[model samples]
Target: MKIYEITFSPTGGTKKVADSLSNELGRDITGVDLSDNNEDLHEFSLKNEDIAIIAVPSYSGRVPATAAERISRIQGNGAKAIIVCVYGNRAYEDTLVELQDIVQKNGFLVVAAVAAIAEHSIAHKYAKDRPDKDDNRLLKEFAAKINEKLKKKDFSTPEIPGNRPYRKAGNAGIVPKPTKACTQCGLCASRCPVGAIDKNNPAKVNRKACISCMRCVSVCPHQARKINGLLLAIVNMMLKKACSIRKECELYI
Candidate 1:
């Protein structure tokens, strides 16, 4: 069966987890990077014979709205999917279920699900370097389980953790601001999925259009972009109870 790895990972954690799982499956994998600068939402397609591994990072216990919109545009072509939601040490509340619904709407049947942990994109001090060695080993075991299921053609649905109504959607449109180190290189603006910044003036961001994905802040080579310090502090304090290092990866099939 053809295996496709479709992922939206600006900070690389989600991608790393997806890659580990895909590699352990011992199948040739096709990467569909949702973060590609020139990605056209309309261009992706799948077939009934294909198996898709859809991965995305959890942003505030939900899928990034921009990535979800882009993913919704693809035709799943009746492919079976393995949905993965990777988050920082914080909870992944509704992300996996939300992603499952989105993928199914695009005509894919989700046969498996995973909620994995990765380094926090913004609060790097929290999870540190994650989907680390321990996580990788768990991912390998998860893959072996998936491979066995596929071999037996077992397609049973597994229980994915999340409340039905889901926690209310969190703040969506907070844009990152450039700090004193910004060189006006326009990288953030150009790479922004929603075109939220003025190309000529990278410092100025249209907050209404930003999805608070922290892509710009994480991708800045000079580390010039930053979220509001007060906001980060508040968020961290509120999330501290859910932020204890839960570092194992698993598969539900």
Candidate 2:
């Protein structure tokens, strides 16, 4: 049986959590990076014997539109899927339920679900340096349980946590853009999951299409991409309450 590790991680925090769970599952894992817009999102198909471990970060307590759209195109073909939502200390809210629904609608059987905490992509002070050593050990324990579930003949769909009607996103706050430090390097443009950045002129960003996932900012080698300082300060203050508390991981099977 093949193990497919499918993920949409912009700033690497989600991927970090995904990797730990995948590593404990088995060796020779097939990685499907959902963040790459260059890849043909619709081509892959999995057999019934295969297991798909899908991991994605929560964007404003909802599934990122780009990631959800790309994931919807994949043909699961009745393969078992383990849905994982990695969030900062802030709540994951509807992310896991939305992901479970998406994967199931795409033809995968939902067998397990996990909500794990990682360092905040935009806010470093929240859940700082997470999916830490302790989280790793706990993830391994979660993986072992998932492995056991795979052995069962009658698969039961686990109840995942989240809202049916997802919360509507607030006003478009601030989107990150390259600063004077930008070298016009095309890395940010090419690496943008939503193709919001222009490849020829990396400074140009189509804000309408941008999800503010921070992929460009995280991958920028020059430390150029950033949101407006004043707006960021406002966000920092707002999220302080939700982010100050440490959160833990939970698994359902």
**Lowest lDDT 10-mer window, candidate 1?**
243-252
**What 10-residue stretch in candidate 2 is worst by lDDT?**
166-175
Residue 201 lDDT (model 1)? 94
Local accuracy of candidate 2 as per-residue lDDT tens digits, 1-253: 8999999998998888889988888898998999998888767888888888999998788888888888898889989999999988889899999999899999999999999998888777788889899999999999989988787654789888888888885434457978999999799998988898889998788888888788898899989999888887777898999888778899988
| Candidate 1, pairs of clashing residues | none
State model 2's lDDT.
0.87
Give per-residue CA lDDT, model 1, range 94-146, as digits (tens): 99999988999999988899888888877777778898898888888888888
**What are the lDDT figures for the candidates, one per model?**
0.84, 0.87
Indicate which candidate wins on lDDT: 2
